[model samples]
Target: MDPWQAGLARELIMRLPAGADSAAAGSVLQPEQLDGWSDLDLHVDLPRSAEPVDLLAGLEIWSVTEEASADRQVLRAVITDGRRVDLVITGGGRVRLPDRAPDNHIRALVAQAAAKLGRGDRLIGLHLTLELVRHCLVQAMLLRDRDQGTTIHRSGSARDALADEIAGLDLDDLGVTPRPNVVERTVDLYARWRSELEPDYRPDWSGLRAVIDRGLAGR
Candidate 1:
């Protein structure tokens, strides 16, 4: 029997609206064995009439706070008990990975980095920088035809396993010393991978690239 806690999952499921359906995902779903650190990974599917924001509002009983909301496809949050909840909500359709999910995910981060940088917030910039690097690593793995779902669902060990296979990249411990350059380096790294993986793939990184370069010059 898995020792991991399912109380959170059960409670979350109970709170979901009548039309909503959910199942185990992430580490919790990979193996039946569970532990103290095993949180919940609930993939929720809502009927066409249901909305993620509405569902989130209902979660107020648990003092849930939204971490990020992107349409009805993704909803992440933290509960009052300090456990993180990642809900990938779909509109009655199954959640499927796109062929170029890495490409799409990276571009979104670049845009976010630009917005946060404009606000002159080092803290948010640092966070985005870290996320960018991580996504790039994952993207590279996807390009090589590895199991994208499992790799992302098991991020900690997945990163380690991929890192061992890819040589000479120094992905470990990209400290936030030169904050501006961190973003630049991450984008540059992604571009290199993108070029190798999909030669025809193109994204408008000029604007963000300019900003990152300008920041590096002043530093």
Candidate 2:
């Protein structure tokens, strides 16, 4: 990690409420350790009484990683208190944990990716690429759920209705106007590997790539 980036992450971690555990920071990618990308990932255990939104007030957000399935919401805040920091808050289910719950597909994927990452294999590059794609796809699904006013716990008819509403929304408004074929290709890849990897690993890449493409293109 870059010295400046590590300093920033440490500074942000220090600023969090006392008693915050698991206060560690890492680069977004393994190769980033060589290229110096400097994207920081921080995990903190927040108190139940703590309001993340209130803590994030006035902080300029670089991005928000939303995982409805895990009820994990993270705010990548930049230019806050003169430092850039990524604040990840887990909503009850503790998305950062490496265990699988019945309804938490997003967490399962992340945990699997992290496990692969820890293996230090020669195919780390390929694992990293797949993990990046999976992360983007899951984030897209969570954003879709949020836009449709559905929570991770919602299911049955309510979940189906929300999914339809999300599918019906104008892709352009979400900043995703890319070709459907490309989205489908990524989704198909995700589907093929999802079952082989984890039982809860269901990533709708078609919907996800659209959102990711929009976010990147918009940037």
Q: What is the C-alpha RMSD of each candidate to the true structure, in Å?
A: 16.1, 13.8
> Where does candidate 2 stray beyond 4 Å?
28-36, 53-58, 68-71, 76-87, 91-219
The residue-by-residue lDDT of candidate 2 on 1-219, one tens digit each, is 345556655555555565555455565334346221134567766654434324443334322344443455564433312233455665342322222234244333332222232233325424544554555455455544655666554544333443443344332221112434222333344454444445565543222332233333321
Error of 2 at 58 (Å): 4.9
Q: Against the true structure, whose TM-score is highest?
A: 1
TM-scores of all models? 0.35, 0.32
Cα lDDT tens digits for candidate 1, 28-83 = 76554433233467888766552333444433222122333344665444333324
TM-score of structure candidate 2 = 0.32
